[model samples]
Structure formats: structure tokens, C-alpha cells
Target chain A: MIDKILSKYPFPESVKLEIKEELEKLNLSADKIKALVDRCYKAYTQNLMEPEEAAGIVAAQSIGEPGTQMTMRTFHYAGVAELNVTLGLPRLIEILDARKTPSTPMMTIKLLPEYAKDREKAKEIANKIEATYLKDIAEIEADIKNMKIIIKPDRKMMDVKELKMDVLKKKIEKSLKVDVFEEDEKLIIQVEPSYKKLIDIFEKLKDLVVAGIKEIRRVIIRKEGDEYVLYTEGSNLKKVIKVPGVDFTRTLTNDVWEIYEVLGIEAARNAIIKEALETLEEQGLEVDPRHIMLVADVMTVDGELRQIGRHGVAGEKQSILARAAFEMTVNNLLEAAIKGEIDYLRGITENIIVGQPIKLGTGDIEVTYKFGGKR
Target chain B: MKVRLQDHILVPKHEILSKDKAEELLKLLGITREQLPKIKTSDPIVKEIGAKPGDIVKITRKSLTAGESLFYRLVVD
Candidate 1:
């Protein structure tokens, strides 16, 4: 019956092979296995087959013979039914047909506290203490030990406020229990041992202030000769000179100058050159913006402004598009103005034809045109 | 010739037995607990229905080749 049932279903060849091997190991005759398969096949078609039905057939046929102790366990649970088969007989066959194996290499690490003497035990204790307590020491080492003090007055005065500085220093010392020292223009406070955490807090505050200032201010860059320049609008030359690494000699300052006084001379020159091109583009010209910038950089001598074009510094490498495009843009703008004038005249003519009084002058005006053969 | 007859034990077929009753039944059959394998807590079917430990799971076995067979109900906690 089981064999007939197995034949009706399209069981995979692997599963069929497994069943055949199990039957052979159980010493069951081919005819007996065929008869069991036929019975299972009949049950499946009749809808009388259950999960355990298949399991029990496999179990009884395989384990009923001698030396075969297979067990089929079935479970009905809240979720779904399940069947499990234990191959005790096949396991015994494997054990009889098995081979021996060898071991492999390994390593281990062990602490030697048990074998330690007095000094070694003390050293181990200290190491353990450091491991547990000194986890944050390395991270705290980067914070500044001294506070950086900055002072700026709302209004400028010839005399410095020495008393105010002394009082401020005293107040900070009293509140934080830290030593305050005055350098040339700044006050530095040494961080106390108890307030080491404040070092990181203060550093973070400084970073935030600096970032805020940078965000509020608009700094632009330009190219001058072989270098770049940095400049901020409406800033004094002295303010620009204060920036480190600047070459002050090459910097120019006229009423309408394009020189950068900050950082290296090359940087200043670049800023001026970039600004010159931007100025030209702002005039609604069609010059390739990059060409104007490059020409400005090459034309400027030692950061001094110089004109660039056919008769100027870049005459040898003049571009026809640069000149033609500039001319065409100017002409187009002029044409637009003339069209506007024509539209104005047409509007006046339409108003007159409709017999409306054309508002010409604000005050009383003389009648220049003959209306109804003049009065 | 006179024949002696033994009284048959009456069993309720419709009464569903709990895990404790099943254990009592197994005791009557002279079977040890080790003879029955346990259902693991991590079994997919048990977890799918949210069955916890100490819950009884019943199974019915019907085989065409060997006819009706006995099965075990697991205590899945």
C-alpha cells in the first residue's frame, strides 16, 4: 500500500533513494516494501492519510525486523502537527563502519597571580587599579589647562581699564579656585585639579563662538598673479594686515582698489584678480567669466591693478569671443531701450486718438498741437 | 466445559485528557518518562501558536500499512 502511495505522488528521486536504502538496511524483502508502498498510496488517494500515518508506516516496516530500533514520534501542537523519525539502527551501522581521527594544535593565555611574590602581587594590583580607573585620562590630556581670556570694549578709549581687569581676574579666581595670570594683551587662567572637566567644556564653548563668527561674516577670495587672496567687504586695511603670513609690501590700497591685505601676497593677488572678473560679469557682459578672471590675474603686476584686453597686458592671447560677445550684449541692451521708447510714443498716439487729455506737463502748458483749427 | 471471563475496562473515547491525565495513562501502561522524547521550546510549530511550557500537544496517528497507531502528546511550556 505504501509503495502504491509513493508511486502516485511525484516524490523527488533523492527521497525515493533514501527510502530504498532504509528498506534495504532493515533486511526487508523487495516484495514487502512494494506492498507497504501500495497501501500508503491507497490511503493518500482516499484522504485517510495523516502526517503520522506516513511516519508510522515508515517506522513499523523499518523497525519491526531484528537489530532495527527506529522510533517515530508525532506531536500535535497549537500551531501545526509535526513528525520526527529517529534512526537508531542506521546510527549503529555508522558506528560499526567508522574510522578514528587525530587532534590539532591550540594555545592558551593564563594570568600568573597565583605564582606571584610580594612585589609582583603589588604590581598586579596597581595594574588592575589603573585599568579600572584611568580609562578617561588619555581623553582629558588634550584639553587646555589654562583658560584663554578675551576682552573687547564697546567704545574705544585711549586709556586701558586696568582696574576692571584686576576685578575680573579676582572674581574668576574666587569662583573657579584657579590661578589667573596676565600676558601682554590676554589673561590666562590655570585650570584647577578638581575642575579638569571644565577644560573640555570651555574648549567646546570657544569652538562654537569661532564657528558662529565665521558663519556671520562673508569672506570672498580672488586670484592675483600666481597666488590667491582673501578679503571681506567694508573692512579696514589694518584689519586685513593683522592676518598672519601676509606680504604687506605688495598690497595696494586706493579709493577704489582691488588688493587683498590678508595672508600671503599670492593669496591677496588671487582675491583681487577674482573680484575684477566678477565686476565685469556684474555689468551684464557676455565674456567667459573664467577668461576675465585669468586675464585679471596675469595682468596684475605685483598685486597692482592693470587693464586687460587687445591693447593691454593680455594682448598676445586675445580671444575674439570675449570682445565680440561683450559688443553684442551692449548692442542688445541699447536695442531694448529704443524699443521701449517706440512703445511709449505709440501709447501717447493711442491716447490722443481716443480724445483723452494727454497729461504732459505738471503745470499749465501751451497748446503746441492745433486742435479743431486752433482758438 | 465452563469458561471464565474477565470484565473489560470502560474508557471514555470523547473525553480529551490533559497533560496530567496523559501522564497518569502512561503510568498505567508501565512506561518511563525517558522512553518519551521531549518537544523543544524553540520548535517552530510550538512558537507559531504561542504555546508555552507545560502545554499539552495531542497527535493522532493513522497508517494504511499498519492500521491505527498510538502517539504521544508533548508538554510544551
Candidate 2:
């Protein structure tokens, strides 16, 4: 039965063997095998990428042309102040430029199965992750006459955070390396009268962390589908994933660099693809994922993320002429000269500049003439 | 801090080719290490597979839209 199908179709040897192996495993008749073989042949031929095709140029145009239409604006979180995610053209530029830190980093935290379904548990997790500073929960006033910094703790905020006054006083005493005393409800941090700079001490007291995770600025618990998801304003993927209740498998961050640091370059590559695709789609542009994949692959090909322009992939091109053509032409040329570098003229840009056919497509082929042919 | 690169969901299945197989692959593709798609020697999969510079590594990935696909990269510095 396998021999009959093999002889009937002009499939490759590998394809024929695959069909034979598959047929032996399944209880399929001759008719079904024929249909399966036909379908496989169609799919294989449809997916083949032609050799010598200028794929890079096509990908560039596919992404770059629509890039012009993207609106130049950062999207503010709805009804939230100072929480803006860079989107549209600016974000697209950032992704391609391979910016180390995004303008507004964020994370979407998914809880473990047991905690995911409960709102109260999710809120508890949010409180544990959200960072709170001393200034956020206290009014610190500077008194020049007494040479003291007055810290008036918000009792309601302290109670909500489950913080004790004694702990707060001890924390301040230890962090500032100074004596702190309570008068009524106010905690007074006394600066030495001989201390010349009383204002410096007051500024330092305002920025101290009072509670919660350091990197996570805000965490909002919002129910999505069947689970309560925590949307955070800042990203701390490495630390956040270690939280006991976090579903590390599904927890994701918008910062590519954070992903790289926590999960390595492979995750960073995937993040680049996702971020680039979202940026384009947000502006109503339709592009093949393969193009984005190519870009991501190029950016992380060296096991590190690199921008498309100078100071990254382009600047580090092996070909001196290629680097010169990109930007800082005179600087590149001078450096290459000093280094006594050799330009092999192998790449597309260098070849084109010198009026030679690019080493791509038809130019990649070489036709050598025989000394004496059978004429 | 040590990062577990192999545990990443995005990392594909990777295998190092033996000397003969690597030579055959290069001859069949008619390309040098510089011409082939590059994978850094420091890449996690390359480190996991114990592949050296100039060695060929085969990567297999399962894509939802494209099903299973195979790719090759030459390990480089």
C-alpha cells in the first residue's frame, strides 16, 4: 500500500518515507493516504522561501512604510496621571532603536491558580509588591529655627499598611543614623545645631523607602476573565517572579531588558517581536509576523540586544565602508584607516557604493568560462 | 545572579552537530561560518549544548501558525 502511493506521487525521497511511516501508524486506507500526501505537497511548496530573494529589503519596507503613518504621541493610562506607556511612532522607534529602558515600564502579574480567583488575595499581593516611600505616607516639614525635620505620619495610611509607630521610628533612626523622638503624634528628627546643612538632611528623609518592594511603584488589581490580574506601573521581573503566589509561567513584563536579565536573550527576542508587533498594530498597520521576527533575530543575533542605527548593529558592521555609509562617515573612515582595516567588499552597502553589483540575488552567482569547450 | 537560559519558554530545542555532520552541513550548504546565520557562543542554548565556536547548531521550534520548523545557526564569538 505504501509502495503504491510512493510510485503514484512525485514526492521527494524523504516525503515518501514520511508518508510510509505515517501510514503504518494509522489505520488509513489508500484513498486517505493519497489525500494526505497531496495536502502535504501543497503546504510544503507554499511555505518554501525562494533562494536569492531580497528578504531584508522587503521586511524593511513592510515595517518602515507604515511607520510614517503612526501618530506621534505617548498614550497615558486612562484616568491615571504620570503613568504613560510610550506607544505608536515613539514606541516603534524605541523598539527598533533598541532602547535599554522604556519610558514607562510595566508588568502584568498573574497569580497562582489558588490565589488567582480571589480578589482579596490579589489585593494582598498588590500591597506586598507596591512600593511606598516615606514622603508618600508622611508630611515632612523642615523647621530652620529648631534645626529639625518634622515627620507627621499619616495614621490612616500607616494603619492600612499595617505599620507600627515604633517600627517606623526605629527604621528612621537606623536609616538616617540620627536620634528620632515623638512629640504628641509628630516624629521629630533632630539635626545637630552645629550641622551646617540642615536642608540636606530634610531632603534625604523625604526619599527613604518606608515599605513594600523597591522597584514596583504601583500595583492595581483588576479582574480579567476568571482571574484577578495585577497591573503594575513599574517592572521588576526578577524580583516579582520570585513572589510565592505569582504564577511565574504567565507573568510578563513590558520591559525587554528586564526580560533579558531574568530569562536570557531568547525571551528578550520574543519580547522584541511582541512589542514591535503591538506598536504597529496599535496604529492600525497590518504586517507579517515574520518581518518582526527577522528584526528581532537581527537585533539579538549576537546574544545581546542592539539598536538598528549607529552605536549598535550598524556601527559595528565588519565592513568599514558599510559602517561609513550608515553614519559618522568621516569618523568611521578615519578609524578604519588608523586600524589599517581591510574592506572585503562582500556586503550589500559596500558593493553598492563602489558601483558593483550587490552580493545578493543574481550577483551571488558566478559563471566561470572553460578554457576549451566541446564546440 | 545566575540565569537559567534553558528554562525560558522562548528557547527552542537545540542540538550540537558532531564533527563529520558539521563538516557535511557546511559543504552541503556551500557556506562558511561568516555567511551562515550566527548564534553567539555565549547564547544559553549554545552553552547548554556545549557547542564551540565554528560549530553548527540545529534549532527546532514549534510554531502555532507554521507547525514545527528547523533552523541552523553557526556559533560565533
Candidate 3:
């Protein structure tokens, strides 16, 4: 689908050929160029970078001197790093073309003894040991065990000790279920039974510190009168909402959208109704925008607000009498009434004929029969 | 085949020929493959005619500016 859209766009063949040649000169494959283009496209659509920024990077590599290779390399490296984080190693592993099967192939082990003399003697001892130990251990493996570990860092000469303590703490955390604490000149670790196997795994992974994986942050917006109030926990709402045209007044309150925008939608919906109600009271006249929110929510899908035109809001019911009278007199009368005019004589007469209390859109509330029932 | 030569340039009977004829002409000429420029799959000119890889494309060479020559690509399949 994306290819189809790109096809319509008129990129000059000469330019494309030049780009291809440039890529060839750099020893980059067509696939790599495509991947870079895909990253640029994603960044462009996500509003992360301008099209010019993507184009500048592409053009610079294509026409600029070899000295600019460093900049190009940096751009590609940044793109790949982001891509790796977005599609984590586990996902990439699953999609790897080399992996035909889901399960990894097991390594076969062959043990050799040190010497011929010791080999025969070791075999006999191993056979006897395996017969007794392996049989009992295999049978007892069905039992489950629980264990815990706590870790503490050292104080006094803290700076030097801190580095060593962190390394040790990470090692313990990786290998076992452990908690760490900082104390004077020592680090304490508490460990559990299941963590025993992980001790070696952590030792290996200690050097591999994964960086650049970003946690998605959300923003919340609350409707206050004619404007939206934005907030987020642990974030400076005052500073963030300073975007031009956005109004921010801090008071004790919550709105679903505001919460959703700041802390994610699920948290906003799960907000306690009681707490919301109390907050609404505290911030008077700022009714838990939830009332309008509920109406709007029911009328919308995926949280997008649709406009309520002259015909009334979508997915809402109109009265039978209103619907019937809509074509003839009601439309004009409603328009006039909206303009603040009242014809009491016509209203009472219509009420008597319709055999119902006529609802008027204008003036003071007083029911008076000013005309006979014949229209 | 008796080929007519006008002013030392080869001239064929047909004014325009199909892809088969064009390929045959290129083969008849002593020109190497690299002399002919490659067209990319993503090229808009290739897309305009809905051509894919391995398809023969014909373009007219013209000079628009005083010193700049541009290739105006026509039909492709």
C-alpha cells in the first residue's frame, strides 16, 4: 500500500540513479537504503523530524564529499538504534529468516577423561555416582522451593565503594531474586533459591548495558469551560501546558481526557468516580466534565469527539413529536424561539390539540390558555 | 541484410521499432552494456508507464537548456 502511494510521487529517475550510485560507492546495499528511507518515512509521519531533515541526510550522502561520511554514518546508526528499540531483540529473533524453527537447537556434549588410566577408573566411579545421585535427584526434582535475596551498598569511602557495589548488586539481581541496600563500607544482598541458575547469566550480561529504549509518555487534557486544562503526575503541568492557545489553571480536579493525555487512557477511565466527584466539588462549577464526557464518549468511538450540528448530536434520540413537527411549523418556530421570541397563544393552543404540555424554548415559565383548541 | 548508410550513419526502413527491434539494434551496435544507463525500479518515469524489472524502456534524448541534456522517457512495459 505504501509502495503504491510512493509510485505516484514523481521522483526523478536521474536523481534516483545518482542516489543508487552514491549508495554503491559507500558500499551500502539497496536494502539498507530502503530501510533508511523507511525509518525517515516513519519519523516524518510521527512528526519527529521534518521532511527536509530526512531529505538533507539523503542528499548530503548522495552528493557531498567523503568527509561527510561520518555524519551519514551517525544518522544511519541513530535510525538503526531506534529501530532496534522499537522492535526489540526478542521480536527480531522471532522474525529472523535464519530461524526455521521456534526452538533453539540443543548442543550435544561429549566428555573426555584426562588419561587412559584415569578414564577407565573415572567411568566406573561416574557410573556408580550417577546410579545413586542422578536417580534420587531426578525423582526429588518435583519439589518446589522458595528463596529471597537482599542487597545493600557500602557507605564511607562511598564513591569508590559505590561502583563496586553496583557491579556486585547487578550480578546478584541477575543471578538471584535479590534486594540491595547501602550500608557503611559494605553491600548486603538477599537471595532466593530460583536465582541460583541466573548468577552465571548475570555475570555474562553485566557488560551488556542496553540503552535507548524509550518508555511512551502520555499527556492528559481536561475541558474547563471553553478550554482544556492539561496535567501529568511528576511532570511540570504548568511548564508543559504553556503551549500557545492552551490554557492551564491548576486546582484539585481530574478530567478523563486530561488524565488520559497525561497518564494514558486506561488510568483515566479507571479513575475513582468518588474521587472525581470530590475533585469536581473542590474545583466548583468545573463539573466532572464526565457528564458531557459520558454523552460524548457514548457518541464517539476510540475517544474522538464528533461535532453536534443543527440536527442534534449523532447517535442521540429525537422526540417523536419533534421529528414529526420537524418538517413544517416546528423548524421555523424553533429558530424564532432560539432567537428569544415567545408566542404563548400559539403554544397553549398547540398544547391542547397535541394533548400534552408544550415545551417552549423561550421566555418565563407560565402556562395560560389564551386561545381555543381549534387550530 | 542490405543496410542503407546516409552520411556514414546507419538508417533502417522503419522510423520506429518495437522493444524486440530496439534490443536487436543494441546487439548489432558495438556499444557495451554499461554505456546504457540503468533505470531504477522506483523511478517515477518507470512507474508512469507501470513498467517493472526486465522491461525495455524507450526515451527520447533532448536538450532543454543551452548545455543541459535531458532524457524524456516515453512508453515502457
Candidate 4:
């Protein structure tokens, strides 16, 4: 049936195969399948990029034109209160800029099948993943006379964070290197007699991450569909991917650099494309993902994430005039002049600058009429 | 890390080509070894697949423009 449709409509294999799969699931009649395939074929044909078409400029304008309409706001992500994500133009710029870290880095973590549906198990995972500072789960004070830093772990909060007293004690002991002894329901760290030493211990202990990965500031367990999903306030993909009970395969983070570091450049390129498309889609703008893919390919083709702006892609252009046109016009032109640079006039921007037709689309062809075809 | 590179959604399919296959691919694309994209020897996927320097890695990714697309990279230090 699919072969019949394919032979008639000339559908791409991928699209045709996908349609056939959906049709099989539907138990559709033969005529119905053909009609559906026909409609899909039309849609596919319309979307195809034309030969010799200027895709780069079209992609730029496709994304650039709609980008103006996006609001420059940090949206409350997915209606999850207090979780602010940089959206709209700023985020698009951030992705394109290939910033080392996103202004608001976050993760969407999936749990293993057993832990995914249970609120308790999900909370446990969330607590284990979230960075829990001593200040967040305990009360601390400097006893002036005794030269001691007293930490009183909140029983209720500790329980909620799934933290045990001994585990907390060991972590605190390991980090501070001072033996902790319990006195009157408080953990005490003896410091040197100097007032400065007491102050030092107090400050140091205050910010100690007694539980979980330090980079993950907060992990909220929100029920998404049938499973509880972990949405994080801050991202720590490297550490998070290693945590037990996390469906490591399904975990996602917005830190492209982190992805590059942990997963390599291929993954980073995919992230760039995925991130840019999401940013555009979130703003209710419809831009072909291919445009974003083209941009991403440029940014990551060299196996390193290079920004789209002056410090990266534009700055490194082969054509002097193109680079000069992008930014730092004086600096680029002056440097080119001093170096006796050659302008090939091969690139679109350089050709346009010299008042010549760019070697693109129709301009690329010198003769409209070809030599007569052989009989 | 407990995660396998293969399991990561962002990572595309990567396979190292034999010397003869690599030569064919380069010739087919009408490009030199230097012209192909470079993937660092230290890259996690490169390390995972045990691809050495001068090896050509064929990457197949589910692309947005075409349903699937092919990419080649020169493994470099």
C-alpha cells in the first residue's frame, strides 16, 4: 500500500515510512490511506528548499524577523512558581552567543520507572539532587565566650530533605575538618580562641552544602503527565547524570557547555538546535527548525561552540569585507589594509560591497542560455 | 558516569570508518581530510568509540531539514 502511494506521489522515504506507520495504527481503508498520503505529500513538497536558493539569508530573516516580536522577559517556566527562565530575545541571543553558561541554567530530570510515579521516591531524589546548604536546613550561631560554632539542624526540615544527623555530621566534619560533637541537641565545632577564627568557622560552615550536588541549587518535583518530573532551578548536568534513580538517559539540561564537556560536540550541536527551536516556539513564533539547525551547524561545526557575534563566527569569516560588514568595521578594514589582505569577492557580503551580483541563485550563472543540447 | 554516550538523546550515531572506507568517503564528498569537520581526540564520544587520530568518524543524525543527514569528521588531537 505504501509502495503504491510512494510510486504515485514521489514522497520522501522518511515521510512516507512515518505515514505508513501511523496508517497501520489507524486501521484505515485503502482509499483513506492514499488520500492521507496525498495531503502529506503536498505539504512536504511545499516545504522543500529550492535548488540554488539563498537558504542562509532566508534562515536569518526567518528567525530574525520573528525575533523582534518576542518579549524580553524572564518567564516563569511552565507555570512553576519561582522558577524563572530567560525567554524571548535574550535567550535566543544567549543560545546564538554560545554563552559559557546560560543566565538561568536549568534541567528537566526524569526518574527511573519505579521512582517516577511515586511522590515520596521523587522527593527523595529531588533532595539528593538539590544543593542543600547548612543555612537552608539548620540554625547556626557563634557562642562568643566558648569559641564555638553551634549548628542546630532543624529536625523537620532535615527529615523533609531526607537528611540524617550522622550523614550530615560526617559531611560537615569532612568539609570543615573540625570534629563535631553534639551538645544539648546542637552540633558544636570548637574553633581557636581568636575571635577571628570563630568568625571564620561560622562563615565557612554557613555556606557548606551538607547534602546533594552543590551546583544544583533547587530541584522541584512536579508531576508531569503520569510521572513526577524534576525541574531544577540551577543545572549540574555532569553531577546529575551520575546520580542513582535518575533516568540518566532521559535527563536534560540547558547548559550547552556542560553538554559539550560531558557528552561531546555532537550532543552540544543538538542542544543548540533544540534550545533555539524551543526559544522560538515558546514565544509563539513559527520558524523552520532547519534555519536554527543551519545556525547551530555553523556555531558547532568545528567541534567547538563559537558564538554568532563578533567574538566568534563573524570575526572568523574568510572574507574580509564580510567580517568588516558584521562589526568593528574600522578595525577589520584597517587590519586588512595593513596585512595587504585579498578580498576574493566570493562571499555574498563582499560581492554586494563591490556592487557586483553575488554568486548566488541567478547571479551565479554567467550565461542564461546554455550551449545547444546534443541531439 | 553511569550514562552511556549511545543512550544520550543529544548524541547522534557515531561509527569509525576503516582506512579504505574513509578514503572513499573523502573522495565521494570531494573534500580533503583537513576540509572535513574535526572532532577532538579527547572528545567523550571519540574516547567512547576508541577512535584514534586520523580516523574518520561517520555521524548519522536525525536532521531537521532532511529526516536524516550524514556528517563526517576527522579525529584530531
Q: Tell me, by lDDT, which candidate is best.
A: 4
- What candidate 3 gets wrong by more than 4 Å, as runs, is A1-375, B1-77
Worst 10 residues of 4 chain A by lDDT: A72-81
lDDT of each: 0.35, 0.80, 0.32, 0.87
On residues A169-270, what C-alpha lDDT tens digit does candidate 1 reach at each position?
464456455565765544554454545555553454333211112221333333333334433223233433332333333333221221222222222234
DockQ of 4: 0.63
The C-alpha RMSD in Å for every predicted model, in order, reads 44.8, 5.1, 32.3, 4.1
The DockQ scores of all candidates, in the order shown, are 0.00, 0.30, 0.01, 0.63
Candidate 4 residues B1-77, lDDT tens each? Answer: 45687788889999999999988888888989999888998899999999999999999998775677788989999
- Predictions ranked by DockQ, top down? 4, 2, 3, 1
After TM-score superposition, the amount by which residue A141's alpha carbon in candidate 3 deviates from its true location, in angstroms, is 28
List model 4 lDDT by residue over A210-297, tens digit each.
8888888878888889999999988888888788999988899998988999999999999998998888888899998878888988
**Model 3 per-residue lDDT tens digits across residues A46-129:** 753342233323432432232222221111111112211112222122221112221211111112223113434333322221
Error of 4 at B42 (Å): 2.3
Give me the runs in candidate 1 sitting further than 4 Å from their true place: A1-237, A242-276, A279-375, B1-77
lDDT of candidate 3 at residue A192, scale 0 to 100: 41
Residue range A1-375, candidate 2, lDDT tens digits? 768766876565556667678878997887888788788878877766778888988899999899888887777443233456778888888888877778878888889889999888888788778888899889999888888889999999998787888889998888888899999889997888845667777878888877777888888778788999988888888788777788777788888887776665666777888888887877789889888888888887776778888988788889999999889899999999999999999899999999998878888989999988988
Best by DockQ: 4
Model 1 CA lDDT for position A167: 54
Give the B-chain TM-score of model 1: 0.46
* Candidate 2 residue-wise lDDT, B23-45, digit = tens: 88779889876776777776656
